[model samples]
Target: MKQVLISLLLIIALHTTAQQKTENVIVITLDGFRWQEVFGGADSILINHDKFTEDKKGLQEKFWAATTDERRKKLLPFFWNTIAQQGQLYGNRWHNNFVNNANPYWFSYPGYNEIFTGIPDTAVNSNDKRWNKNENVLEFINKQKGFENKVVAFTSWDVFPWILHEERSKVYVNSAFERIGFQSPTFNLLNEMQMTAPRFLGDGVRPDLLTFYIAKEYLKTYKPRVLYIGFDETDDFAHGGKYDMYLHSAYMVDQLIADLWGWLQIDPHYKNKTTILITTDHGRGDAKKEQWTSHGAKIPDAGQIWMAVMGPDTEAKGELKTKGQLYQKQIASTIASFLGFTFKSAKTVAEPVSDMLSK
Candidate 1:
């Protein structure tokens, strides 16, 4: 009788451990968004600089405060107010909590490849439009029992199709100016606006707002188990030396995330069962101040990045201050762990960040 009771208790504990709260996962990326801005808010050197900021008084009034805490809240209200309260934020170097890219090249294609493939392939060194040979975690997740045909990506940059290898991976990718094929009033209006809208970033890239609305509508309609949203305005604006627009775009991205999270909480399929992971492809420079507009192998501190996670399965540790190191490559396995799977590939994949997972 004693042996039977112990066996029963052990079985129950195993069953409970197998059941994770995260049923759906959403991954978001902000291209070239620096950890400096993410942790410390608006930069004092760039905010009022005559070369970078156009409307110094207006920008300062909107994003500036005496304290870093207040300034970050003003710039990214949802991140500081919501994620900080409910999730974990990493990569504040001030506290020695660091997140960096495993890849040597601190650019878009290589950084993104490291993020999703979990392999910092030094061979993936260029931003040229070419199919990625590596197997991404998204494709692996799509092949899972319950996630088949339920993985999709919506991106503002056109290069994502090649980066994600949409053709080979069979993952549904709606990027750049591509029109939504869905037949509905909402999708129709979105298609029209996206097609006819002025191409501020050129013909290959659309505004992040359009990408958000389209992805949000798809989330409501198709209800993908795994969805990825890649916003590009921060990188583009910074490269153009438009600090005001960069700050505004970052603020808009935060608002969009808040809107999406609000909707997810009320929806029956996603409420309390969905996890959102947010990070950046790469970091920009800050040592010379002028180098903040560019990132690559030549730029110092470009490999530093940050990550935030919020979900039922993740503990509410808030902003992480303890000394630790995380890499962009770990994100692939981390996303898979949330969904109760371990990401694997022909290449050696990095291990997941165990600290982010619940005990």
Candidate 2:
């Protein structure tokens, strides 16, 4: 009897410790941001663009009057003023930065796969394959004894189902051109909207607004500990060279982030414990001319990306000028560290960017 009683007490203590150390971490991927956007501020690109002509002069005026740091703060105001002010921003400088790739092709799928798995898989070349059977670090963590119900992912791209290996139902994901499963009424509505969403006027790309909405709704209803929201509109618009549309899409995403963060703050359970980790899979070119917006295999700048983090264990009003560079894989390791979870991927990068963590 005494042995059983001791075992129960130990189990209770372990459970309590796990509950206290756990945190809700949400990752938002901003598909194609130029490093210049964070480091350079608005320059000649704003002036020549017809759509931004009105705001161009004002932006220039503020940029010139402010210090370089201040200008950066202005362009990504929310990040510099709020998120960066509270957490850490990476990849804007030449300091101790280190870089690596999980795949030879530093494009979307490879980058994302590296991020979720902790290392790049050389064998995986394209996202052409319809399904991913490989286990992800997120999935591994979710299967652990204490974290069984905590991991979830929502992405705008149809490939995520395969990318994260959710096609087999191991992970929860809503992707693919065709709707595959059914859930609640709210999800049904979301499915209907996605299915019926009008394709872009000229090209046939499907609008991803529905995915964002579904992710938001899922967050509100499920309150999962880990959430991944991937937005592709900016990447699509950038590729189309629709400057106005690209900027608008980015702004809209910004608003959504503000809303998401606001909701977290107001929620009784997550208000004090949630962290928002935002980054991009890749970046676009430096050109802001006729070919201003686009990124891919041909563009060297496309491979570069940055990250911004905010929330619990993140510093308040802090900026990190790290000399050490990190690749996409570090993101997963950092998140696991924040959540007090053990990541099981053999390739998972264990080094957490310390500057971002709360002091």
Candidate 3:
């Protein structure tokens, strides 16, 4: 009788441990967005510097606040008001809670590879259009039971198809100005608009706003279980030395995310069953304010990054103030863990972030 009772209790505990509440996961990336802005909001020096801000008065009116908390809320209301209230935010250097890229090359390709592959291969050191051989967690999830044909990625950057190796992975990737193949009315309208949209960044990249709309429409149409949205305007504007535009893009992206989250809560398929994980590919330099426009192996501080997660499976710890270090490589596994899978690859993958998971 004693042995049977112990056996029954063990089975019940195992069953409970295997169960998860998150049935869907959405991963969002803001390319090269800095932790400084994410945590401290608009920099007093940069906001007013003649070299950086073309309309100091206007930017001040928009993002300026007396305190860091107020400034951050002004800049990213969704993050500060929603995620910070109901999620876990990491990588506030002010609080000594650090999140850094494991990859040595602190640029786009390597940073993204580290994020999705769970391994920061030294060879992935360029932003060129080269096919990635690493198996990313997205493809891994797509191959899982019930997730087949339910994983998709929409990116503002043209190189994401190569970064994700859509050819080999078979993950649906719609990037840059590529027209959506779907024939729905929404997709058709988006396709027509994209064809005529100004390529302000260049011919190779579409605006982040377009990318957000495309991804949002895809979600409404197909309801992919795993979705990735990569926004590129922040990085592009910063590189062009347009500080005002960079901040504006950041604020716009925050609003877009808030809109998506609000929609998710109302949809029966996604309500209370979806997890949203947000982070940046890499950080920009801060020691020299000018270096804020760039990120690479040369800039040591560019390796610093940040992450935020809110969902049924994540704890609502808000902004983490405790001192702890996390790596970008852990993101792939952390994403998979939400859906009750351990992401594995040919190379050893970093373990999931235990702190973010529910107890």
Candidate 4:
């Protein structure tokens, strides 16, 4: 009887500890990044396109290389060096691993909707700046115990405020040119810096670097249980036919991710318990120079995208050079799983990736 009692007590104690573990989750969107450059490398053909680049020789010397792996490493060294080795990456279509948006509309609104709501709604066929009717995963998480008022979003595009349905969701969305308010000296400095920087498209989009700094300060200060940051320069640069700027933005975003992960490891609230899920709202065309800057229903495979997961509870599988496919709707469930929750998909179209979580 004594031995049996001891075993029961041990089991209960372990279960309680597991229940008490605090897991922080951060979701980042690269905004219309392509898997071609993510997995394969910089496109040699596109580098010399007169329409896309002004200094082909200079760009080539910096990002071009004899091999795909070599080029990718130079472009995104932190990702290839640290995240790839320690985390899991998917959507390398060349290896038959596919991840695509589920929404029929292969654009920002629908793709982001599918990602956050866990289902593709044909009703969201346009990128109109209207409040989203669908409920998002962040809102759902906020309703959960201990997560109320602890969910926040920082996005470079003003459209995100509508996508998140901030008015209805009450998720504390500080997006685009909207200030996040003063939390620290660093955040205040960024606020002042924003005043001096030139506004993009009349503040519909802010600089990606500014967004990163604001979100970073928010994470360090408030320690929100769930955070989402959307960086949009890649998409903007691509549309403007500035390939060099696009490439540089991609590299900068990687470093931002590295910095955030490093901070999480140092912060007591996030150390050893933070999980990051990085992905894009859409994928741009890359079949030709023209297609490289385009993503829409007409663009082939524009809905296809990629994702990376890193945390204490994730497998160290690195780049998934194998046969598999994931839909954007599955991301919400994946995020929930990272925090030890079993969330039923809002649309119930798919489940979380079984391999993404730790055993």
Candidate 5:
């Protein structure tokens, strides 16, 4: 009996150790998403602004509210109702969660570089499509013992292939209209829909919904240990000054996240063993109409952004209303920490937000 009890304890300890050593990680990015809409909901100030949308009465009726709490819930019900209840939300400037970009350039390439590489580079100045020179944390993780060939990136933006250095990194990358062939009916349906759906941008970019579906299919099929999803409809609409489409895009993406979370809870592989981080490449402007439409060196406060983390491994802190700064660059290391990997990047910029761990 004594020997049996000892063996049982050993088995339990081994299982727990394995669980802690290999946590699945999902990193999601909403391109150029603003922090304003995240916490305060639809900007009551910009909802009906003439530059953003001419349908003033329609906009007011749809998103208007008496308070910030009410408006945010209406705009992003999943974030407010689900994620906030289970995880942590940062970069609510009003609440003192000082989350913002670390790079000087408030654009996609530089911002994404900081996020993946954990370093800010002045050379990464423009949005020109080119392979990044810096090695991202994804590549580093892929080189690790247990994570080799386990990393997958699915992006709606065409530039992601270059941004993450897919060629150099040797990480599996499917961007824009790139879809893997699957015998499943779901994949077939999504591919057919993409064929009929209107192309929102150039370079074979399809609707974000299509991207979401493709990623979902890939998730169930491959079941990668590390997955990165890049959704661009929110930024695309914002750049086009289509406030209605932007709002819809944000809300729909939130639904995708909720659905994924629900599915994860049922999947034995991901249930209670995955850590997901939702954030943006960069932040849009909040000051003026033009700035709101554009993000760059000229726009003040364009570096401000937000991030949310939820999983069994993370603490149930909800929103970080406390006062402190968070850099987008730290995300890579944070992910590494959750997956039982250390970045050890020579071009390191910052340490992981250690409080992010609870597992």
Candidate 6:
């Protein structure tokens, strides 16, 4: 009887260890994707009239398919239909509400710092500030047992190495400036992309396409447990006041996101055990008729942001109709919970929002 009891305990311990080993999490950020775009289309949330065209009825025939949904379906069919249908998204309608200016600056670096560090800063005034990211959630997880070697970050933004403090040998971050392994074909393709895509005004512009390419390469080579891919094309296009470019970039991001999700399904290492979280660092300025070329200032709705999570652990909250606000800080805790990690930070973890967790 004693031997049997000991055998049962050993089996339970081994199973728990295996469960922990198999689970993985991926977080992807669209630099300037408004919550409006995530829930609906680009028609209604145009901060700039220049960006808002009447659906280009003619282009609908040439560019889009028969219906608006079908047209968008072609560009980012996974985000609009597949993930939303299978997962949960927030901040479009009244149901899933989120705060504007979650970070004081309402801009990229500050917002991203907040999202990864799980805290808000009231003093950050510009993107120019040299980012000093300390104790990012991923960094914390990397220090723990079993997660030390299974983490990575890829970003179109050149500054992400600073934002996440990836310069530390402990973190594996491959950004615009990092050298991908030269031997791999993926690395070769990425190098070609960087050469073709010029740096805009020395600020460093990484199109979503390049970001996706790097992520795909990383996944193929090293299947890290926690992966972050930051896409900056939408923000770049928005800053340029190129509304068409902005929308086109948004569509492109959607398509890539879909592809990554699908790839996970076919890959033996990731199938059935992985989770994905998609969100934006922040939103665009809420100018109904402005030139569609600004953020960081206090526009009426510019501060708002949105997020979506789809995984085996996520509960299916279909088409939320009520209004509720989620803060960027909650992301750290939510992600920790999803991976079966006991969140120890009282400062970071609140009761996991019921809308996000599996029922």
Q: Choose the strongest candidate by lDDT.
A: 1
Ranked by lDDT, the better of candidates 5 and 6 is: 5
What TM-score would every model get versus the actual structure? 0.96, 0.80, 0.96, 0.92, 0.91, 0.83
Better of 3 and 5 by TM-score: 3
lDDT of 1 at 164: 90
Candidate 5 per-residue C-alpha lDDT over 274-326 given as tens digits, one digit per residue, 9 for 90 to 100 = 98999998888763556777888788878999999988777889989899999
Record all residue pairs in model 1 with backbone atoms less than 3 Å apart, i.e. clashing.
Answer: none
- Write candidate 4's Cα lDDT for 1-359 as tens digits: 99999999999967854854438899999999898888866787778788788888888888899888999897888778987988899999889999988887789999999888888889998888998988888988888899999999999898888999999888999888886566677887888888888986467889999999888888777889999999999999988888888888998998888888888888888998888889999998864637878898999879889998887777798999889878998998888777767676345646888787753
- Model 4 scores a C-alpha lDDT of 0.85
lDDT of each: 0.94, 0.67, 0.93, 0.85, 0.84, 0.70
The RMSD of every model to the true structure, in order and in angstroms, is: 2.5, 5.2, 1.9, 3.4, 4.7, 4.6
Q: Model 2: residues >4 Å from true position, as ranges?
A: 1-22, 41-43, 46-75, 94-102, 176-185, 201-206, 288-292, 346-350
Residue 189 in model 2: lDDT? 85
Model 6 residue 120 CA deviation (Å) reads 0.7
Which lDDT tens digits does candidate 3 get at residues 118-195? 998999989899999999999999999999999999999999999999999999999999989999888999999999
Q: Give lDDT for model 5.
A: 0.84
Q: Which residue segments of model 3 deviate by more than 4 Å?
A: 1-14, 17-19
Ranking by TM-score: 3, 1, 4, 5, 6, 2
**lDDT: which is higher, 2 or 5?**
5
Off by over 4 Å in 4: 1-22, 200-202, 287-289
Q: For model 1, what is the error of residue 63's alpha carbon versus the real structure, in angstroms, after optimal superposition? A: 0.4
Better of 1 and 4 by lDDT: 1
Candidate 2 per-residue lDDT over residues 1-359, each given as its tens digit: 99999999999968755654337788888777566666655545654466544555544554443456766655556776677666777777555443444355757787788777766667666768456545576777677665676677777676777788874536687653455354889888877877677766322233556667777888888778788887778777767666545555665676678778888889986887888888887776666444346555676566777777888677674555656667777777777777766566545454666666644
Q: Considering summed lDDT, which 10 consecutive residues are worst modelled in model 2?
A: 199-208
